[model samples]
Target: MKVEGGCHCGLVRFEAEVADGPVEVLACGCSICAMTGFQHVIVPQSAFRIVEGRRETTTYRFGSGSARHIFCTQCGVKSFLTPRGRPDAMSLNLRCLDEGHGLDVTNVAVDQV
Candidate 1:
């Protein structure tokens, strides 16, 4: 399935191909993710693409500095990340997606919850 999303201000847009059912959505308890209420699913970098607004995005790293948190500079929304694990994957925020994407969000496990 192809999923689309962006920041609250619409300054950052992206599209990704993901498995259609029984997806793994994580509820990260790390400092930044905890503070931001960021729940997500990790996907391979090749499965995801920035459709627009690259100029409006910025990266933030901390601690071990492996995770690349990409946020919209315009709205300060942390929309996605180059996950520390498995290096080739990205963690995209589900809440940022366009509506009617047919995601069964409520059925997934919340890792840190």
Candidate 2:
């Protein structure tokens, strides 16, 4: 299934090709994810693309500085980013996906790291 999403202010937009069935997502309890309420849908880098606003985004890194927390410069919404644990993948914020994408999301495991 193909999912399209964007930041709150519509500054940054993206598209991702995900599996066409029930999907598992992670609810991370790390400081940044917890404070921002970010639910993670991890996808391979080849399955994701920035459809627009690539230049309108900014990145922030902390801790080991491996994960790149990308946000819309205008709205400060981290719709997607590169995860430290999976450099070959991108973590899309499940909450940011546009409605009617037909994603049966389940198995929401919470992790504190």
Cα lDDT computed for each candidate against the true fold: 0.83, 0.91
- Give Cα distance to truth, residue 105, candidate 1, Å: 3.5
Cand. 1 Cα-lDDT: 0.83
Once fitted onto the true fold, the runs of candidate 2 whose alpha carbons sit more than 4 angstroms away are none
What is candidate 1's lDDT per residue for 5-67, written digit by digit as tens? 989999789999988776777887777887887887778899999999998889998888888
- Candidate with maximal TM-score: 2
lDDT of 1 at 107: 35
Cα lDDT tens digits for candidate 2, 1-113: 89999999998999999998889888887889989988899899999999999999999999999999999999999999998889999999999999897889884757642
Residue runs of model 1 more than 4 Å from their true location after superposition? 106-113
Candidate 2 structure lDDT = 0.91
